[model samples]
Target: MQKKCTLITAAAGLVLALGAPVVGSLPAMAATAPTSSVAAAATTPELGSGGHVFAHGIVTLTSAVYDQGRISVEGVITERVRDVQINAGHGYQAGKVGAGGRFSASVASDSPTFELRFGTKYNAYNFATVESVLWSAVAPGTPPETPGPRPTLTPLPVPADPNPAPEPQPQPEQDAKQPGMPNVLAVSGTDGGWTNDFETGAVESLFTAYDHARREATVTRPTDGTLHVQQSSDGVTFTDRATYTAGGGIGKFTDIDVTLPEGSSWLEYKMWVEDSSGRKSEAQKFFVQEFPARN
Candidate 1:
């Protein structure tokens, strides 16, 4: 069942994800975006030596450096992108998209991979983009260029759902799910948030869950890779939790049902995917805060 109770009910729950859909293997050079985009500009990621320059559409990555478990990257985007976020599981770094659409972000990670998310006002619903990247270390001696002159910061906008469509609705109770179960629910939250992570490429995953507690959280990318999971107590640190050995349904390998650990509140959990070979996807932070018992 989805976990939806909170000591205090949040203004509709906020679930954010940082990672791309799983891929069987990195592409040779660059390929097209996997998820078909409703917007003409959207593209699938192409991972390569170009400093993880996959989604070079609106926000583009140009350079990357890794030192002492820290991975740093630089890129440029249209001024529409207000800020850049680089999440590396254990730690994350944030930088603002400056004038001329230039920005840089760095983070510490046990691995040299991360999910890229940005904020901008020009897009509908304060539109943003998410990209998955595998970065390399900077060669000895040569210096990486920097975007001189500190960029100014702007507020990240989260569009208001003044009037959400009342079509597909969630169950009045939580949607409990067992590990490895397929999620066929067509639900979006009253105030759900989403991005194009690696799972279901280009496919928009709107929020969907009822009050307090849902166990079925799904990812659709990496249609063939075996799904493994990692758990975090503080949303920063994570550890090996479980793996899904069950295969997908007749033409679907995108089901990712999230199950909370015993004795744990959904609030204290953060999750990401790992392939059979140990390659991990970006971590998604979501919680269906349980509603307190009413008197």
Candidate 2:
């Protein structure tokens, strides 16, 4: 049997001779991307600022201007795919001047000839003109193009089964309440009704809570009071929802909350109140503040 040489070396002496550090020496550093790649990825598309195409529809009236008041022009709309409606009174006369002054009249269905006119009092030459003919189309059943960045749809997370049972499902949030006309309260102090504190100059209330998303106004009243509130988008027919009792006084009063829609510049709230003795209050007008959503 050959004699084996047993050489025992200490760990410290081995490390010093080899000039190598131990295994657990220094902390690790985080990984980072290159600065150039980061800057390039941060770039975004620039939206066009000039005029662009609005809708794909034949122009019933090509750049037509309304010079004389109450002037009517007849034209035919060819290849009428969608509802070819004329927007006569939209630009400057929305809900302000009478409907006859500025308004849109729908062209007859399947008829090539359509008539358009201005109000009798519109005498200013080149005052108004039809900017464009607006219409809608029923698109065929197909997958629409994806807008903006590709959305990473995350799958619903599921918990592991404890006893080989089915996983629980996530519940969806309740649908928002549909908008409706606000309630109208009668100002009669009779029948356990409370009188409206109209001692102040003017008091008005709003009942409808709008999300400013759907862009539909179906006003509805929330509570019972002596203040009568109504809703109207066209300003022609007013829908009464709530009524408040007037505590024998002379000043005007109202109680309502006006929730403005998103991207809206202004909101108009109209109220109609009456006294106990069948005295109708003047129509009160309230302007809503512009509200923008934060990212």
Candidate 3:
């Protein structure tokens, strides 16, 4: 039997596994802006001689959450050809993540970090912020390269309903999950204030559960933006809960004293952001658990 537990609520409205449809009016577009110049963008890395090639081995890439976490990342393999610039020939290799849950990339460079990148502003929710994992070739005719722990900092304390017994509703269809990535829950205790080293890539914002006692959360962003916290009762319709602003080019803040809706013991919270350019980011959702309480 599944053990029923309430979501630990936090200030930034970070839920564990919940989602809400986007609503409200769109922001106004800029009036008259100057035309920006376009440069030949380097989408992939350039390859060169004396670089590391893929030996007879397999390099596996795993998702932080699940397989179908709605997250699409590219494994970038780059090598320095010239003294300063890395752009040259096929010095870089990039490949799409296969449906069979394989993140195999044949790197042609001697030194390459198999980094996962989701182009700029392409937000990733309910996934890992530090998406890149490094791999080193073992030897010829050896087993495929084993993946080490992806460099991921701790996530902030996520929020959920404080009340234990809220009325339940029909659950929605779950997000598609990768085959290798399975859904599991684990709880542990630790001491100290909440801390999370957030990573940047395809994920613009992230919410994680740290300590259940503190009931607080911290949000960090690379650019100036506005963070909005929202809550939901049925895990479908959500209303505005709070708003925060990060001025300057970057922002980092921690929120406290987050309260849930009256008469609702089971609530799921999510967060969304608007960058300085008024561009909205994808919402980050968390999990919500609603099950029968044991007598």
Candidate 4:
């Protein structure tokens, strides 16, 4: 489902709502706070971010930054959107749109494949997914100059060169640790996979949907305030079944057998984080297919 482009990064494919392109380094931060370091990157990669307007101009993702495995995002959400949240893997956080029509939230991941969704309580929303964190590990420092607003470029014809130098190929992601490497180049995170799936996909992808019979899903995700695990029979409409806040950090929350309501074929889930006031950011939605019975 991802488009093909040599310069494409998951940040750029933010459904194009983002104004700029972003790429991250491999051999990223560990599960806990970024504890180790790696070699400096050949070129400092741009921080994953967004400041563009989309959704008929009602929603604006002010900023979304991904470094190592931690993802932090700030945005100017419309008042219609009562809640704002970010979720990757099982880790998710929620916040209400402030009086100024803006909200800020963050989440952590155990893998590189993470996605950020900003939306209202209703279906109106926008999404930014980090398909894969590419590039070398580096420390946070001065970011490259952000390009000006989208410019209108007129395509012009040019004479073709008979002999052009071979384009340099990008280096592969490093799987092992680097001795002198900094945690990773973060755009805004105060404290956060550059190897294997961590560099190639989101933490959510690292986890599969719950196996109804077993009542247990794969992988463990981080949690802060509270995590709401809701199910949908049709994958569109969803209802709350259980709430979890007892356990902290990354843990298996969906460890119950599904009741399997009538007409339930596909099992879909959406995670929402609730604040102290019970306010939840009805942000992103993901589903785990109910695998067919084994012979």
Weakest 10 consecutive residues, lDDT, candidate 2? Answer: 1-10
Candidate ordering by TM-score (highest first): 1, 4, 3, 2
Error of 3 at 106 (Å): 2.6
lDDT of each: 0.40, 0.27, 0.27, 0.35
Shift of residue 289 alpha carbon in model 3, Å: 80
Top candidate when judged by lDDT against the true structure? 1
lDDT of 1: 0.40
Query: Taking the tens digit of each residue's C-alpha lDDT, what string does model 4 give over 86-161?
Result: 5566844665567755666666765433333343332233334332211221123425445589988999999899
TM of each candidate vs. truth: 0.28, 0.15, 0.16, 0.25
Order the numbered candidates by lDDT, best leading: 1, 4, 2, 3
Preferred candidate (TM-score higher): 1 or 4: 1
Query: In model 3, what is the error at residue 125, expressed in angstroms?
Result: 20
Q: How far is candidate 2 from the true structure (C-alpha RMSD, Å)?
A: 42.4
Weakest ten-residue segment in model 3 by summed lDDT: 1-10
Better of 2 and 4 by lDDT: 4
Flag regions of model 1 displaced more than 4 Å: 1-52, 120-295
Q: Candidate 3, residues 130-239: lDDT per residue as tens digits?
A: 12222222232233223599988999887876877877897634543223322211112122443333332221233343211112233222122222232222212222
Q: Is candidate 1 or 3 superior in lDDT?
A: 1
